[model samples]
Target: MTQEAHVTQGPLTTEAGAPVADNQNSETAGVGGPVLVQDQLLLEKLAHFNRERIPERVVHARGAGAYGTFTVTADVTPYTRAAFLSEAGKQTEVFLRFSTVAGNLGAADAVRDPRGFALKFYTEEGNYDLVGNNTPVFFIRDAIKFPDFIHTQKRDPYTGSTEPDNVWDFWSLSPESTHQVTWLFGDRGIPASYRHMDGFGSHTYQWNNAAGEVFWVKYHFKTDQGIKNLTAEEADVLAGQDPDSHQRDLREAIERGEFPSWTVGVQIMPAADAAAYRFNPFDLTKVWPHADYPVIEIGKLELNRNPRNIFAEVEQSIFSPAHFVPGIGPSPDKMLQGRLFAYGDAHRYRVGINADHLPVNRPHATEARTNSRDGFLYDGRHGGAKNYEPNSFGGPQQTGRPLWQPVDGLTGGTGNHPTPLHAEDNDFVQAGNLYRLMTEAEKERLIANLAGAISQVSRADIADRAIGNFANADADFGKRLEAAVRELRG
Candidate 1:
């Protein structure tokens, strides 16, 4: 039989699908001369590479994201008239991004760091984003010290490496970081995976409904995957084998239809009762105990779809606590207030001014209109309408009926002063409670992880300062870690 010549149709083409003249060389003055300016492809390629990296977030640079829906499991219409959570069994489209706060983009996923749990709810009202973290506490409560705190968590200026001495120095000086440091060194510090980890609205927020009723609230996204953890040795091995373990797991699980889910429960307190509470209700490093404010099941959230393109959808995705639909607002937690400003600013730096134009972040409600326009990558059609508001062109206007409550009456101090300190502000109670709840094996693993890591600090003073944090969490917790470090020191 004669073998027919199987001819492949064509040669490679440029982005415009035009036939390329040369694959090897750019248009140049001569064969071995400098490249010519007429080479559009060469210029385009180099220019694109130069702009490849948008600014990385000063924190939460490493992350994994997925598409999901939040289905309301209970009727909380009385507490929050927010459309997504009011109707029982209503499915609200959501995108969740799990992140490690202190690591860079290429850092290990299982490193002992607080994971960011941010959810963007695309609701009928608008886009409601609950920007939170895995742990219900933070190292600092005030916004003013955020830059300084992040500086310590990042690289040492001279060595350009993360130093325990630098981190501990900040913790020692700040004092407010003690509570969160305890949680960070606990078993939950390095979660087994994005699935096994729990998510929390670390700062208290507000939920209000019709009839002028307002309630202070916090959100908890409990992983139905069941909380699990890896030993320090196991995590180190995984990190070496796969730095992108969490990212791969989330994508593969969703692809196999083994969707990860979390039960959404909320702790609510009456607005009137907040002022009289024993602790600062707005403090980020504090949690409302279930005994005092039980978790009212509101819904379930599941991540079922992986991003089609990781960089466009997952990397570029942004969440802001300030992006609330009506009926939900921020609490006065100093950290939360700081985040409200920081989240958007970081997004602006990372994805540019037109980030809102990205599919993942753009508000779903078609009726949405704002004065925002014309920046670096302006894509809006310029509206071809009025640039400013208050025009008689029947432009978008704010509504009066579905009202927004003034926060002036919500927060009260002696005019412009801090609230009086409460006894519960000591910051040790919750940390101690968390320590006592740990299983003997879990406690053992936590102590071992701390001592093993802290032993590398080299400086005796730095190791001692870090070990002292455990002592505050529990006497036994500190003692074991100290003994281990002492042996290593010798």
Candidate 2:
């Protein structure tokens, strides 16, 4: 059916399909004598209005999404056996969501925060989700500290507002946060719009080919619109003038046939090289330098269509890193490991257990066949199929082959253990390198940004500790930050 047929132009009817004679006036007893309880329509309207909203996501509550196509432009058969990327020119339907990390649903888009770049691929094999962020590195390497890090970013319990003291204290204590903190304070922190920034699958992932050869890979989506960013003053003005600037820009551009696109690429590392790499390749707080493994262009991702219903199509949609195809699998990255369980569990709580049955979340090219039966909002898609395996009724059975190859070594007994340290694993080196690579004006802006927040911290010692981390990264960075903060506080 065409889009126009979906529009209802007939006489109004109740949800139960009963024709309603009068919708404007409720059926009252003797003309508004206490608004009679017999009016089912009035009651229905009131109840639905009360329950219109579902629970907002704990993080990334402010977001926008678009429907798109990912056309493979290169042959990667030597690296992966994923059916979606099996041949050049293959196209897959995709939905991409852009979000702010710390904002609520009503928050403004032109803020200085890391944007979430979560992509869902509706492929022949199954749904593949790449849950990433705009920046390649994160605040911390381990998932154990995730709650604490977010707590620092969120409103303080006592004050009920985000406190600079809380944010700085956490970063000061966790030296590993230096790299991401630097990135956060830089020019790109406030992206000009969703279409102008780059996105990265920050964590390492495992990719195995048909020959069972394993490789580690990272994904990058370089915007075709070119990089653009807003300074602090520009962002403040835009935020106040029009809070929905980013969303409006994206929607109107698509409406005008100016679809945004990104060049898709991946940096693939041989599985053996990961063992003896300079730093732990799986560290979420670090990046594998392009010199070690250059990104190879593989595809083009174009967002040509806007969501018809923001609430149904975008809000109800879900993405999980654990939703992998045959060739792709999770790495040993601690942050990625925790997310494998957390993302799916969050959807079950926030969106309901049958969330997968929603049109926006369902697989496109293949029917989802599972013995798992009913839950909230279950559509009865299986239609009385056997609910369990090993039945005479011929229920769906699992494939004998596993999705990816198993790890070779299994030496350690189960206990609380830290990731094994590699030769050059300390946190400061990369952050320091980033600082030195900045142009003089860029460095000035970064220092000013850091100082602006650090100076707001009440405790002098906390401010000192925070600046000390930068000092550890580079003596000049620390000195300049200290001088800037001192001037600001004075």
TM-scores, one per candidate: 0.91, 0.98
Give lDDT tens digits, candidate 2, residues 280-398: 99999899999989999999999999998999888889999999999999899999999999899999998999999888999998988887778888888888777887788877778
TM-score, prediction 1:
0.91
Computed on alpha carbons, the lDDT of every model, listed in order, comes to 0.82, 0.93
Worst lDDT 10-window in candidate 2 = 1-10
Error of 2 at 327 (Å): 0.5
lDDT of 1 at 23: 73
Clashes by residue pair, model 1: none
Structural RMSD, model 2: 1.2
Please provide, for model 1 over 236-307, each residue's C-alpha lDDT reduced to its tens digit, 9 standing for 90 to 100.
899999999988888899999999999999999998888778888887767888888999888999999888
- What TM-score quantifies how close candidate 2 is to the native fold? 0.98
